[model samples]
Target: MSNVKDTTKANNQLIYAKRNMWTGILFGFGIVAFIDEAVFHQLLHWHHFYDKSTTEIGLVSDGLFHAFSFFATIGSSFLLADLHRRHAFWLKRWIGGIFLGAGVFQLYDGIIQHKLMRLHQIRYHVDVFPYDLVWNITAVIMIVIGIVLLYRTQS
Candidate 1:
């Protein structure tokens, strides 16, 4: 019974060590979503969330996307706050997690939304292949960096 308890405690400690990375991933995802909306959708006016729909619908879609991302950011903040309270926060792992999350989000948008769903491309009136190529490749690179950082994080 003591051995079993020891194993359980060890497992919990291991999980705690990786918690920052996971939380950072969540924060990264939300931040990327916000940046996407700000840059592509609003700032550049390259494309809306759903270009196939009416303009008003497209605006609404963007709003919903913002709301979702906002909620994700908020949720991650709560978890991070708890970790901070416990003095378990590890900044490096958290940042790596953010990178992982952002990379994953970008990759998904580039692959699934851009290629698979046939949604709006990166930008209109542009040579899409280069944009797609660059976008996915960059995302992969970011993900690799994130993986390396998280793996090398001190326990």
Candidate 2:
């Protein structure tokens, strides 16, 4: 009976942690996307979400991307609230998820979007090497930090 109870408890903990982490990941991704879109795309006029075509098309793409970010943010917030209400939210695990998500998003934008898809550059007409290096390295660092945090939580 004791062993069975312990196993059930452990399983519940695992499930809670997983949920918290995933919620945090969504939050992080949405926040970063919002920042990138607002600062670089909108504020700085650096580039759009999709810059391969006319400005009008780019604006439309940006609007769609903004909508995605908004939905992700709201969805994650609701999830987090539910976890909190259930008293199952794990702060450390959630933090780890946040870092992981942000890093993953940034890396994807830097490599796949900026380079592979030719969607947009960090900046235009200027030397892009420094920008690319900084962007990629920062993303790697964030990912490492997130992984370390998540690993530690497992113990």
Candidate 3:
């Protein structure tokens, strides 16, 4: 009987961790997108989301991006609520997921968008190298923290 109970508990933990991880990823992506759009695109006025196009097109693109991020956040919220209802959500794991997601999104933008696609640099009218270095380094740090947290949760 004790053995059966222990097995059940372990199984439950694994199940919860898996579910929470997915939720964390979605939430993470949404958060990163929100921050990038809000900070880089708006507050700093670094560069529009789509600068290759006209101003009207850039604004339209930003609107679409905002909409996507909003939907992702909404989806994450619903999933989190379901997890809470089941009493299976793990805060540490969820946080880890957020860090992972944010790092991934940032890295993707830094490497793929800014580097490969030439979409836009970190800032247009400034020294781009410093900004890019700082941006990528931050992303790496977040990813490392996320990895550590998620690994700790396994115990």
**RMSD of each candidate relative to the true structure:** 5.3, 3.7, 2.9
- Poorly placed runs, candidate 2 (over 4 Å): 1-13
Clash totals, every prediction = 2, 0, 0
Q: lDDT score of model 3?
A: 0.85
Deviating ranges (above 4 Å) for candidate 1:
1-15
**Candidate 3 worst ten-residue window by lDDT:** 5-14
Q: Which pairs in model 1 have colliding backbones?
A: 24-98, 25-97
**lDDT for position 46 in model 3:** 82
> For candidate 3, lDDT tens digit of each residue in 1-155?
99986676556667889778778888988988998998988888787777898888878878888887888889999999988776677888889988988898889989998999987778886679988998999999989988888998884
53-143, model 2: which lDDT tens digit per residue? Answer: 9999999999999998999999999999898776667788889999999999999999999999999999999999999999999888988
TM-score, one value per model:
0.87, 0.90, 0.90
User: Which pairs of residues collide in model 2?
Assistant: none
Task: Please list all clashing residue pairs in model 3, or write none if there are none.
Answer: none
Best by lDDT: 2
Tens digit of per-residue lDDT, candidate 1, span 97-154: 9989999999999999887896778888878899889889988988998898888875
lDDT of each: 0.85, 0.89, 0.85
